[model samples]
Structure formats: C-alpha cells, structure tokens
Target: MTVFLIWSCSGKNASEISNETLLIVKKIEKINVLMGSAVGSSGHKPNQYENFEELKKNASKQELITLTNHSNGVVRCYSFWALALSENIDLFSIIKDHINDDTQVKTQFGCSGSTEKVGDFFINLVNPKDEDSDITKLTPDEFNKLDSLLIHKENNLYARYDAIANAVPTAYLYSKVREMVVKHNNQNALITLSKYKNPHDIELILKNRDPDEDGESGYFYTYKAIQNFPDPIFLPFLEKKLNETLDNDRYDGEWLQLYMAIASYKNQKSLELLTIPFTKVKHQDIKKYHIKFVYEAIIVNKSKLYDDLLWKIWQDENIITQEGFEYLLQLNKTKTLELSKKELNSNYQIKNTNTIPKINQSMFSQNLEENMLNFVLLNDKVFAYNVINDKIINTNVNDFEMYCSKILELKDPSFTEILFKRLKNEDNPHVYLQIVETLISFKDESINKRILETRKKNKNMNQDWGSEALDEILKKNKIK
Candidate 1:
C-alpha cells in the first residue's frame, strides 16, 4: 500500500511542480524565508505569514494537502496548519495519516523555542484547551480519536506519551500507554505512566531503568517520572543514583531534578543524600548551579536535622555561603541573626566575582537586592542602623551604592552623619550624589547646616549635580 501511494504520486513529484502548484510552492517558500529559522505564532510576524493566509484563501484544499508532504518540513507544517485552522476539512483525518511523520522543525512561541517533530506539531495544534493558538478546536469525541491515534505504539514517541497523558482514563489507553513504557523502554512515556501513580508502573520504571545500558537519558526521564510520583519504594534507587553522581562527579545535567526527586522523599536519609554534594563534589560550577535545589529542599523540609550542615556551610566561606546564610535565616532565626551580627562586626569582605549566589528568589518575599540588604540588616531595624553606619564608614566596602540605597529605603536620621562623613571626603561624583540624595531623604534639619558646610568646603569639586543638589537642600529647608 505504501509503495502504491509512493508510485502513484511519483508522477506529480514535488521536484517537478506543475504551473498551478508552482505558485503555491513559491508562496510557501516565501513563508519559510520570512519566518527565518523558526516557525512562530500566527501573530509572531503577521505580515510574513500572510502568505499562508493567501494560500488558504485562493489555493484549493487539495493543493494545501498535497503540500503537507512537501520536501520541506516547514512547508509541511504550515500547509497542515492552514488546513487545521480553515475547518473546511476534518483536521483529524489529515493528521491521522501523519502521526508518524518525524520531520523536525524549529518552532517559537513567545520567548521560548524548541525543535519539534512535525507529527507532534500536528498533535499540539489541535490539543484541547490551547485557546491561544489559531487552530480550530476539536470536539471531545474528536480529541479522544486524535489521542487514540497517537497512543498507537507505531506513532511518534513524544506524541504517544502526550496522547496517553491527555486521553480519558480507559482500559485501552492505559494498556497502550503501559505497553509503550514497559516493552519499548520509552522512559519519557514513563512520565505519563507515573502520573497514574500505579505501583506496577513504578516497578516497571525501576526494573527497566539500567543507567549503564541507557546512560543518563534513561535516568533523566526516570528521575522526572519519580519526581512526578514520589514514593518511598524508589528511595534506595534515588539514593544510589545520588551517590553515583556525587562520587563520579558525573552530573550530566540531571543534578537539579535528581536532587529534588531525592529531596521529595524528605526523610533523614534523603536529607543526608541531598547534603552529599556540599561535601563531596569539588566542582565549584556544579555546586554553584545546583546548591539552591539542595538548600530549598532542606529548608522546605523544616527539619532541624540539617541545622548542623547549614551552620557548617555558613561558617565556611565558600561560593554557596549566601545560600547557607539564607537557608539558616529561613529555618533558624536566632542563629541567622547571630551569624549576621558576627559577619557585620567583622565587616566581612564579599569577594567580587562574575557569579553571585542569590537567595532562591521565589522562596523569599523580597527581591534579590532587598534580600542582600537583609543579609546585613537581618530584618532588625535597630541593628540595621549600626550595620549601615559601619558599612558606610568603611568606604572600602564593595557594593556601596547598593548599601547607600538601602539607607534611603530606611530613611533614618542616624545615617545622616555617616553619609555626611562619606560625602565630605568622597570624590567620586556618583557616590557623592548618592550620599547627598540619601541625606536629603532623611529630611533632618541638622543635615542643612552640614550640607552648607560641606558645599562651601567642596566648592572646588567638579560634580555636575553637586551644587544643584546642595542648593535644592538649602531651598527645601529654607536655610540661607
């Protein structure tokens, strides 16, 4: 049957297009050039893809369908998309034949882009609940039929997984989904199977998983599936994998998922497994990227079991000190403040490096800059004034502008003199302006006299905004 279809269509081969087909082919090629390297949303470049609309309006439905099998993957996708959106023909009928078409195309939706197989693209176009796309919506019956088409073992692997995931829970769908997962070693399909939370499915994933035979891809999806359906039954496997990664230093991009999956178990052993990287892996880059997952997992566990580990990380000055500090801040307030005071009194030197470890931003209510200030302030208003004074007077401290801005946010009068002292000696026009602005924010009468004295003393300073700011302060205070 396949040979017959190929032989019959060989006469009107894409290589030798008739005059009528030539125009549609040229328009399709233009859509490709205008879209550049990736197919985007219909509105991504409306003008560029207007060619598709032109073909939809003037070209016969057969013309568009014929182009679905064109030599170019882009042509095939756009042609199918045109048919799917037009609604003059049944999209499922057209898409059913192409469920196994594995030609890949680059697609962009908003800021994200990925290379997707053409068959998956067809499936996604009519996937229910995607109101944002231009494709026509399908009836529930049609959707079930579409998913049934994809659940066939012969279909594209991703499409099969996605269909099994979305299809109604039925004996056939479950059987097909399980068959693909167990028999074919389709680990990605395991993500869908694990969603059912079946013990048998979990055992299948565990028994079928041989990281040695499948390497890290199998482990990656297995970890993802386990993350979706976390169970204590898989704890030993996760622990062994965690140790293997730590001991071999072989974190081939599965560190975050693996760490969090183990962390999901949330037992003393899991906590110990998550902490292994801090002491075991000597690679700084890996630690920098993945330490937050470990920190987040431990903090969310809310167990003091890891307090010793957090304190150890805090005491040892390393790349992840901020993570340790913030973790302690969340889990142990008294200890966090004590550590903050110790660091403040020592005026700890923060090493300026290209990469700065941030407090896991989502976990905190405050943004990164405010959270950095809290690292010093400890959220204690009384202690913040003293720390601000100490940091401002040091002058050698890094990130001075950031510290100065915090003083403005605080709007306290005690910082006026400290800022004034810096202002009197500070020659950097930018820093001088920040100090003046911070002092002005204090709205204290004492700053008026101090400003007048400083302005008079520094009349020779070459600051563009220097005199203007001082004059504004004088005018605002009505001080001549």
Candidate 2:
C-alpha cells in the first residue's frame, strides 16, 4: 500500500487529492497535533480522535506497519494496538520490537517509562483463558511486574495509581497498598484500601492519621475510607476530636476535618452530635463555623429532625444574613420564598400606581434607597439597583427584573436617572422598551423632556426604536 503525506503545496483543492491520501494525511495530522497535549486535563482534546477506531478499521496491514515506524509514539502505540485488536497474529514479532523500543510516548496519563505501556496495552487486548478470568486475573509474574511499576517513584502518579487500583484485590496487593498508605499517605492508596475494606488495614489507616509530608491532612482520605468501610469504631475518635476542638478557643482547620468525618458517619449519633452545637451555641462566631457542617450533615443524612431547627435559624434576625438566607433557600426553597415575600412586603411599601404621589418625595426616596440597600445586603437572593452608587449590585436577571418591577410599582422618580442611564446603554431593544414604559409611568416632566431629546437624537442616527417606543408612551398618556 502507498502512504500519503500532506505537503505545503499551494492552490490544492479536495477534488485534486485522492481519497486514500486525504485519509492518511488527516490521520497523521491528528496524531501530530494531539501528542504534545498534557494528559488528564482540559488540554487533552478527545473530540479530535472521535473517528480514531473507524480510521483504524479501514487501515491496511501495510499502513499499520508503516505507522509503527512513525515518529510520534502515540501514533505508533495506537497502530500496534489496532493491529493486535484485528488479530493479526503474524505481526507479533514486529509489535514486540515496537513495545521493547526505547522511544517514549506521551499517553493520556502522561509519558510512560518506555514502550512498556504499549506492551501492557497489548496484554489488555488478549482475551482471558476462561469465562471467569477477568482483566484483573493476572499471573503471579504479571502481578509482580505491575507491583514494581507501582512502587517506582519516578513513574507517573496516575499510572501508578491505576496499576494498583485495577489489580485483583489479593492479600499481597492489599498489604503492599496498606504499606503505601502508611508510608506515602497517598490519597489514592487509601482509596484503593477502601475498595478491599480489610479490617486490619483500617487500624493501619487510623495509626497514620497525621498530615502527609506535603502538609495535606489525611482526614480527607480517612473520611473517604470510612465512607467505604462504614465502621462504627471510628465515631468515638471523631467525636472526641470534635469536642476537644470546640472546647479550645482557636478554631483550627482540623475541626473542619473532624466535623466532616462525623458527617460521613451518616448515623443517628453523628446527626445528634452535629445538631447539638448548632442549637445550643449562642456565640455568633462559633455558630458560624459549625453551621455549614451542620447543614451538610442534615443534607447528607436527609434527616427531618433538623427542619424546625433550620427554620428557627433562618428566622433569627441576628444570624440570618445573606449567606444564611441563601443556604435556607437551597434547603427549602418553597417555604423560604413564601417567608421572604412576607418579610420583604412588611419591611418596605410596594405600590402599583401609574403616577408618583406628591408625598414627601425626598423622604420617601431616602427611605426607599435605605430599604433597597438593606434588602440587597441581607438577602443573597434579591438584586438591587443602588440609587446613590448608580450600579446594579447583582447580576441575577430575575432579581434585577423584580427590583425594576418594584421601582415601577412605586413610581419612584428617584430611580429615573439610573433607569435612563441603563436604558440608554442597554442594547436589547425589548428590555429598553420595558424601561421606557416604566419611565413614562412616573409622569415626571423633566424625565419626559429628557426622553424626548434622546428619542430625537436616536431618530437622527436611524436608531428609531427608542423614539417609536417613547412616542407610543406619549400617545398613551394623551400628551402632545
């Protein structure tokens, strides 16, 4: 078979290139482009190779052999695997040579020590001897080879983790993994142990509870291990740490770990332990630290016992700030929204009128701005237009619309300047029209004059939508 490589010739069209040449050129280009990207991250673009298996299916034996000698290691590795998958047993010698070659390949998990990974990939392609023999059923020799690879510190971390994690959960493998957990305090090793859930291994994990050499606390690993194992024995240890930390003045980071561990327990006792501090603690600072974990515990357990407690906390004016309100809304949105509506209405006057009433406009404006600021600051769910600051403080479209609705309902002349500024800058014709309608409802002469001027200027530039909307508004009010 002939191989085709794309060259830098100008004025070439698709019709001029042979179908076979185009396919080969595309495959080679893909291999070259993808080989340099870092694995296991966003840099690895998989869509480029979506048709890789299809291309492999159409590859000739000669083409596969030629690819094995390609400069890009990934291309070579893939070509060898494709040949192996097609059951081309006659090419085993050539494949082995490629596998034993010193050329390094950057794989999905980064660079392998040599072509050793391709050899592993070849092993994966071979079927098991029996129905019960899975990929994990490796011979003693194969297991040892993988174990050596796993223990080699210079190997890629993901490669090492994958080797042990995918291996059969044998006694020897479990013991080696436990040693890795203790020595390296690796999160992956601990997770691998959790897969086995060996009782003796739990004690080993507990013994090596200190932070790793990298200063990353082992509590996360412990939390994950307990989640997998679900042993009751660790509860007392977790509770003791929680109590000790709460007693101390300094709220070290370890307390968070302890709370997380206790939450992971997902037991009645753990729920009670989490709830007691949230309910009994009157100190605002202490409650603040523990409330997040308490919320997590409640959500994790799905316990109805904390419903009233959460509601009580939400109603507490001293404690229910923007963050707390948002948390409450997340937990029980229907109830919180109902409560919020009532609270908001009682705190501020909301009127729906077409005309601004002549009732102390200065005092009403001041009160409205102050109330709007308070509402915006206290409730994370509400958006506010700051009249003095001349900015929309929040980006939520629904919240902004609600604030605009309130301004229109009250027919507040104080918001005329900011609203006009926003209307002039807004590119969306529909939203600009709505703002014009709201402005017209205010019935302020100065605002009407400004709108008329803006409409005339827009008309001159052939940007006549604003002028047309303002004309409709003036006609509706029966103004000349």
In the range 1-480, model 1's lDDT, one tens digit per residue, is 111121112235433234554565566666453242234454355444666666667655766777777766777787777787676677777677677788777755544566888777777777777874666867778877777766664765477766665555555567777877767776656777777788877778687564454554457778777877888888888878776665444346666677767876756877778677777776766665556666555554545676675566555543234455566666655555555555665555434333322234443433443454465454455665677777787745356876798778767676777887887777666677678767767666677667767867775344567566656655765776
- What tens digits encode model 2's per-residue C-alpha lDDT throughout 1-480? 443542321223112333563465456556543332234445563543543564466766666665555555556556665565564344445533433344444444334222345444444443233243322234446445644555543344344665655555666667777777777776677867877877777686566554653333446566656656667887876675556545444344544556666766666787677766655555667666676556554454444555565565545422344544545655654455444544544443333333321212232233333333444434332333343223333223434554565677666677787777665556555556666677778877777777666655543312567556656767887655
Instruction: State the displacement of the C-alpha of residue 474, model 2, in Å, after optimal TM-score superposition.
Output: 18
In terms of lDDT, the poorest run of 10 residues in model 2 is 6-15
Backbone clashes for every candidate come to 0, 0
